[model samples]
Target: MKLPVLYTFRRCPYAMRARISMYYSKISYEHREILLKERPKKLYQLSPKGTVPVLNLPDGKVIDESLDIMKWSVSVNDPDSWYVNNIDHQLEIISINDKEFKKWLDRYKYHDRYPEYSVEYYRGKCEKILDNFEKILDSEKFLFSNNISLSDIALLPFVRQFSNVDIIWFRNRFINLSGWMDELIGMDIFQAMMKKFEIWNPFGKGEEVIFNN
Candidate 1:
């Protein structure tokens, strides 16, 4: 039998984290591209919450959250620094990303909704997270360690998106982060994961392909 499948939305930071884990762990699995506005029946059946980044395990287990999916994939083929074996500072970064950064990112990305404030004001709020991350990057090669850790992968996608709203301005303002983010995007893994697939009819497993080189 084939390995289980993962349903994901291409642009979602949450799904990007899960994909990064699977890619780094060298886990092979099928995939389904999902549209947030119109979720497929198959995915919704398994993921009652109707969120992307759902994992359907081979043993019939279903994982709905992105973090859960990430942990599961890493657990299966985890290398040296993954799992609880050698993890340090990964969890702390995750906490900051999920709790503090994610909160302001939502508002900053949709600045029009917060009409009371200028886009620059909200952008500054989001930039604070990037500034904090940039400081960490300035100190080391990765966010948590010299080597790329789960923390870096989990936060990179969101940071990538956070940087894109005003790419030229951001690049000029923070050249260090621009280079770092560019390096991440220049990778084959990120390029493959971010491709857009044409909308397809509702289908069963293996109908769609995952091109994670």
Candidate 2:
């Protein structure tokens, strides 16, 4: 079978989630690392919106959204049944993480770009997301259950970006959330997914990074 090709950017939270899901599902593919400023022409042609984490399937289908790519990869081999139960809840939280939380996260991370608000204001907004995660972790080790699920894997990358915005401030804000972040980021899956790759050059054959469990 022809392996799918995945275009990714290492530090992007969305791309991180896609790589984690593909790794967890043991989906082998040719990983192409791209730069936001110097994206490959094929990537733009395939996904006009031109976001990273785009998956070009062997069947010629293209999945441009990170969530869709996660579902596609997990469906291939879900030993943990990551998507079978609590799907509605999973989607609900993931949506909030992607939409509302991400809005505040960007503002907080790049306060200079969105100068309308103070850093504290944006930080406060994102803290609500951390509050929600802390409440969930108070009862369970992972979101949705004791074991890792779609919610845990899907949400962690964004939370990681939020945490890195001001590590000292973040660590002080939510103890439970901080512990949870430490645990998830320390996992083998996270480590493997975050391995560095050279920037892709469409003019030449770039090395492929495989995301196999």
Of the candidates shown, which would achieve the greatest TM-score relative to the real structure?
A: 2
Candidate 1: Cα lDDT at 183: 76
RMSD of each: 2.6, 1.5
For candidate 1, the per-residue lDDT at 182 reads 79
TM-score of each: 0.88, 0.95
Segments of candidate 1 deviating more than 4 angstroms? 80-88, 207-213
Give lDDT per model, in order.
Answer: 0.77, 0.87
lDDT of 1 at 21: 80
Inter-residue clash pairs, candidate 2? none
Q: What 10-residue stretch in candidate 1 is worst by lDDT?
A: 204-213
How well is each residue in 43-152 modelled by candidate 2, as lDDT tens digits? Answer: 99999999888999989999999999999988898988888889999999999999899999989989999989899999999887779888988998888888788878
| Pairs of residues at least 3 apart in sequence or in different chains that clash in candidate 1 | none
Which structure among the candidates has the greatest lDDT? 2
Q: Write the per-residue lDDT of candidate 1 for residues 47-111, one digit (tens) a residue.
A: 77888888888888999888788788777777747555335467777888888888778778898
